[model samples]
Target: MAGRAKRLRIHGRVQGVFYRAWTVETARGLGLAGWVRNRADGTVELVARGEAEAIERLIALCREGPPAARVERIVVEAAPDEPAPEPFEKRPTA
Candidate 1:
């Protein structure tokens, strides 16, 4: 797709809360292209590429993630260096 990309590092009670799976579903539902994975540092990381508005919507939704998630904050930044992923999937824990 011809859209922008953003990298998000979500913090706080994110791991073990099905955050990655939730993210995959959300991203795909938004018709985004990217991947989501759990990090070793107890965070959820996502690289999403799609319409800027869609990406913004995803970020807003992530602030209030799955029922079990207690998202404290998210670090968002441009990820123009990242190649867009396809089909929005979940990746192995990093």
Candidate 2:
């Protein structure tokens, strides 16, 4: 099945809390392809490609991140057609 791609910007208590790793695991479980990383401003940014339903589920999960996270808000937008490498990865902080 064809899937949509999206760029997600998660705000609030997302960094330094294993959020990226958690995201990787979650997205992989949903069979998503993309990457996640911490931004300079302490937010988490992720690019995901997968079934719409799975992408939505990943977004919802970001709203309630890892055990130590205190998610405040999430901004989601469509990713460009240029696809990233397959499978999910935790990238270095930007």
Candidate 3:
């Protein structure tokens, strides 16, 4: 399968709203590999790598986050191409 990766910075009500957990579940469901974590600036950051279709689905889900999250904007940048072979995770605060 074709593979792609992206780094996403999600703004607005993305922190303290189960965003990380939601992202973990979403990524796992889509068979993506990466990690999601909360930024110090109250945003949520995630690096997802997987099939093109799965990546697109993950991005679409980020557009409308968990029930408590009110995502304002999502900025996605394509990664420099790499192989990812792991399950999704919610990394500790950094």
Candidate 4:
């Protein structure tokens, strides 16, 4: 399987809107590996590893977030220095 990884900083009204839960579900469903957490800066950060196409799909999904979330911007960067977590999970805010 072709592998890819990315670190994302999602902005806008993403907190307290089931964003982490939604992200966990979405990433798990796609068989991706990563973790999502709320950052102290009020942004959501996601580190995901999976097929190249799946990672792209995850980025698109994050752009829309959950029904209650009004995602404004998503900054995605190649996470080449470190690998993502083993499994998709919701993590404590950082």
Q: Go through the candidates in order and give the C-alpha RMSD of each one to the true structure.
A: 0.9, 1.3, 1.7, 1.5
What TM-score does each of the candidates earn?
0.95, 0.95, 0.91, 0.92
Per-residue lDDT of candidate 4, residues 12-80 (tens digit): 999999999999999999999989999999999988988988899999989999999999899999887
Q: Can you write out model 3's per-residue Cα lDDT over 6-62, one digit (the tens) per residue?
A: 999999998889999999988999999988988888889888988888999999999
lDDT of 3 at 3: 71
TM-score of 4: 0.92
| Model 1: pairs clashing at backbone N, Cα or C within 3 Å | none
lDDT of 2 by residue, 25-44 (tens): 99999999999999999899
Error of 2 at 62 (Å): 0.6
Which predicted model would earn the best lDDT? 1
Error of 4 at 93 (Å): 0.9
Tell me the lDDT of candidate 3: 0.88
lDDT of each: 0.92, 0.91, 0.88, 0.90
Total residue pair clashes for candidate 4: 0
User: lDDT (0-100) at residue 82 of candidate 3?
Assistant: 64
Please give the ranking of all candidate structures by lDDT, highest first, separated by commas: 1, 2, 4, 3
Q: What residue runs in model 3 are displaced by over 4 Å at the alpha carbon?
A: 82-85
